[model samples]
Target: MKYPVTVYGDPLLRKKAKAIEKDHPKLDEIIENMWETMYYSDGVGLAAPQVGLSIRLFVIDASSGADEEPELEGFKKVFINPEIIETKGDEWTMNEGCLSLPEIREDVSRHDEVTIKYLDENFVEHTETYKGFAGRVIQHEYDHLEGILFVDYLSPLRKRLLKGKLIAISKGKVRPHYRIKVPK
Candidate 1:
């Protein structure tokens, strides 16, 4: 089932998520639901908090059902309790959007490469490095687990300019293509 994405202004998005145990119940089902919800929303990545859950779990499919990036083709995976071990490389700016913060895209600066340690859906541990679009997608989703939104990386002036739009989103004034759970 596709879960209603938690929208901006939800307090849950500000709280850091708890790491799930290796044998957490219904882990498989939750992962499957996340995939369904993400694909249904046309999102490249998604986090648990975005679905009203406070768990350190997320899914990413940088391919986005397209062949835009040959390197990202078939690059889909589930990250459970992920931790960034290292981030090395020049920072690059990319236009980023979030499922929670609809209709607000920003050029955010991020490292071009990242090395992360995380678990698969079955709790198998792995450490890997990613670059280019895949790295950007992973970093973006990983930030959600730490209660960091892409908007937070914007400059104060830029944020001030977007303050009204952000508030509108919080008040459920924005309309996204997919289902969202606006904060009450």
Candidate 2:
């Protein structure tokens, strides 16, 4: 079953997610459901926290952008208990959106390259290096596990400018294409 995406202002989204053990129950089913929710929401990536589960898990399938980013064709990954071992290269800015924030989109700055250690769906360890678009996507989803949002990377003035919209989102005043769970 697809889970509702957790909206902004929900405390769970702000909390640092926990690590998932190898023996975590029904992990495959949960991951499968996450994929369903992501595609249904028209998102290329989905973090466990976005679904109201504070676990260090996320999935990415950037194939939809293959037209513009040829390297992204057939690029899919599952990162569990991920750890960023290194981030190199100059920071780059990119427009980003989040399911939790609904219509909110922001230009966020992030490292151009990164190396991370993580577990796969089968709990096998993998240390990988990524650059450009792939690295950016990885960093974005990784931020969710660390209780950070892309909006947090904006300048203070920019954040102030978006305060009202952010407030509206927190208050469940916006309608998104996907189901969402707002703070009580």
Return the TM-score for each candidate structure. 0.96, 0.97
Worst 10 residues of 1 by lDDT: 64-73
Model 2 vs. true fold: TM = 0.97
**Candidate 2: residue pairs that collide:** none
Question: Model 1: per-residue lDDT, tens digit, 13-54?
Answer: 999999999788888899999999999998989999999999
Query: Once model 1 is optimally superposed onto the true structure by TM-score, how far is the C-alpha of residue 137 displaced, in angstroms?
Result: 0.6
Task: Report the poorest 10 consecutive residues by lDDT, candidate 2.
Answer: 62-71
Please give the RMSD of candidate 2 to the true structure: 0.9
Clashes of each: 0, 0
For residues 13-122, could you state the per-residue lDDT of candidate 2 as single tens digits? 88999999988989999999999999999998999999989999999998877888798899988999999999999999989999989998888888999999999998
**Per-residue lDDT for 26 in model 2?**
90
Q: Report model 1's TM-score to 2 decimal places.
A: 0.96
lDDT of 1 at 118: 98
